[model samples]
Target: MASLQNAKNESHIPAELLIARVMQIHACICKLESLKPSKQVNSLFTHLVKLCTPPSSIDIKTLPQEVQEMRESLIVLCGRAEGLLELEFATFFAKTPQPLNNLNLFPYYGNYVKLANLEYRILDENGVVQPKKVAFVGSGPMPLTSIVMAKNHLKSTHFDNFDIDEAANDVARQIVSSDIEFEKRMKFVTCDIMQVKEKLGEYDCIFLAALVGMSKEDKVKIIKHIRKYMKDGGVLLVRSAKGARAFLYPVVEKHDLLDFELLSVFHPTNEVINSVVLVRKPLF
Candidate 1:
């Protein structure tokens, strides 16, 4: 019995070690709405790893001063070796979901996986209800989680969908059309998000998604363009690619966004950078 237990522990002593440990930590956190002191302090070393994977870093100067401050604090809180590993773990758990017996990732990627926003939960503190004009800015095989979330969470008027890759748009169109329930609510635009550039600032919500590692200039242009379209006080949500590089491409100068506040930082189980970073446009 003892030998078998040791063997099980030893099996996880490789590249997947940190991922396994983070899963343990996540399980622990799930039991408590807020982790106790022991959990928080001990979380630093739980996902110990043997080697580094992603061998790159970016100039921190581009981050917002506050994000920079938080980065420094996180680094100090977690020592060099462990900090990197924890980030690996964070990247892992934040992106990928725990796998099932029959399912592993589609491979060919690393760092973090992404969750479909369909699994996302929205909250309301005030009683006022408003339906929104929602925009989904990608076309891919990823299921319609964001649209589902939009339909349920936001009082949605219509779903405006676009994809740069026409084939990808076709895939989205098929999946949405087959859903039967969501068919009438969605309109797929097989073109650049900029096609309806004039409507940028008019949408009640916007969803950008999982295309990581694209050209830096393109990311900047997209963010700048979206800033003009996303409605004031509307939600700006992103589902970045899984296991992508450290920052969202080129870190398009801060405040280039019309956002006022961040709603949540939702990191899911690892796969792709399937994270949901929800922001609200400023009322200015």
Candidate 2:
């Protein structure tokens, strides 16, 4: 009900909780209902960009119905909060409205595909009905997409999408054979993520994907936690091979711990570094 936490089983954002947050934000913005639609929408997006930029999870691409209701509520609440919200809109979009395009995926977001391949390869090496051993972080459409692709590509690696977004899970369930197939592959849970770093330890391999946008300090904290979970001789299939300049790279080097190697970097469409680094925790 309050920032739910579960790193395994399933990760999800309840509709009820989402509605509550919207209500609260709207109450604060109820004085500017008289503003122009353009100004009002702009104001709302701005506030969203600031207050909810890195959504609790990055798995959700489209806002859900309840969330849409909340957005409407904020527009109706239009006043001082709306004014400030519009300012936020001006700052973020500056001019563009929300795009009508599909999959606002950023360029160079290739790690998901590689991670899927790693999962598939592991399944090929193992068996189906794995006993809740593997854990994936940040499962959104991309990760699930990877799983579907892997399954079709080789009938391997049955993994469930572990994300905190219900809407995302809904999307994953849409593919024809995806329900049963995804059910076998995915075990959804509402995880705190930090908790995952604690409870799950020493996997055969930890497939990870780090991003450039994360703050250095937060990134370090996450890596330190991940280091604790890996089993000795365990491998880390990481996205972003050039991350030696990134925080985790430095931390791994500083501690003189992982045996890191770059597997390959492929371009889906001329994007940079489909960089995939396979890292193994040292035996010592």
Candidate 3:
């Protein structure tokens, strides 16, 4: 384990070593949360916070692709740990039962509500009042953003959801299946964004969740990959944390966006993040 001082001097550490360490920390947190004792959970949560907090100068380009993908899981796990500790919840899945009809994302309601507002603002500003096809990448268990869009923006048949977590994808599929119209309209897949090879040229808009972890290489490759498949004038909406939330959902810089044309940046009204809208510049 690197000392806090050693963390500050990250140049000495190998990228693969760091990646392995981070991935192990992520897996450990996932397992530890399932144990009964609250004290044990708190102790693991504290240790994880230290392990996952990267040094400001840490070069993301050096990390492995798998580690980059697991970053968001760590962030969300850390956030859930904090919330769980505060609420005195015994285990990770200690939340109150949800009614089948209401897909309320309790703790995460604020995040999705803010995203819904930002989506509308972007659509209005870009004169895309009604996007024909929309994709939600890294959609979690509830897929609240897709739910909101189905109610307000996209037709049920025009939505596609993707996530790397099979369990999450299953839950999201189940939720979408609960509504006949949504079941007919939505397609949910369990896959990494970087590995998708199917034709996606029909989707005019794509939403990247705040926790969609991507290293510099991962970002570039996926952007290029999606660029090839997305409609010529497609818009990619990337949600990232700003200010102090960078400890978890790190800020996504302009350089990381690579060759895409940046359209606008929108700050959330009730959250600690900002959203970037990027457009596919027309081909010559």
Q: Write the per-residue lDDT of candidate 2 for residues 1-284, one digit (tens) a residue.
A: 12212211122445344445445545544544544445555454334322332223322215566644554344334323333332333233222333112122322224334545554554444332233345555454334334544345434444433455554444434432334544565555555455675444535555454431133355456555666666655555444322111111111222322333323232222222233445555556
Model 1 clashing-pair count: 25
Q: Which rank order by TM-score, best down to worst? A: 3, 1, 2
- Angstrom error at residue 231, model 2: 2.4
TM-score per candidate, in order?
0.50, 0.43, 0.65
Question: What are the per-model numbers of colliding residue pairs?
Answer: 25, 25, 2
CA deviation > 4 Å runs, candidate 1: 1-114, 117-119, 122-131, 141-143, 147-157, 240-260, 268-272
lDDT of 1 by residue, 1-284 (tens): 11222432442244234334434433443454432235443443233111111322334456456554443333223233332332333233323433111112323112221233222443242111344566777634332444445444553556777766565455455545544556676777767676667767667667675452144456656765776667777776665322212222223233434344666555443333244566676678
Q: What is the lDDT of residue 42 in candidate 1?
A: 45
The C-alpha stretches of model 2 lying farther than 4 A from their native spots are 1-133, 152-160, 164-167, 173-177, 241-269
Cα-based RMSD of the predictions, in order? 13.8, 16.5, 8.0
Worst 10 residues of 3 by lDDT: 86-95
Per-residue error for 50 in candidate 2, Å, reads 27
For candidate 3, the TM-score is 0.65
User: What's the lDDT for residue 10 in model 3?
Assistant: 48
In angstroms, the error of model 1 at 169 is 2.2
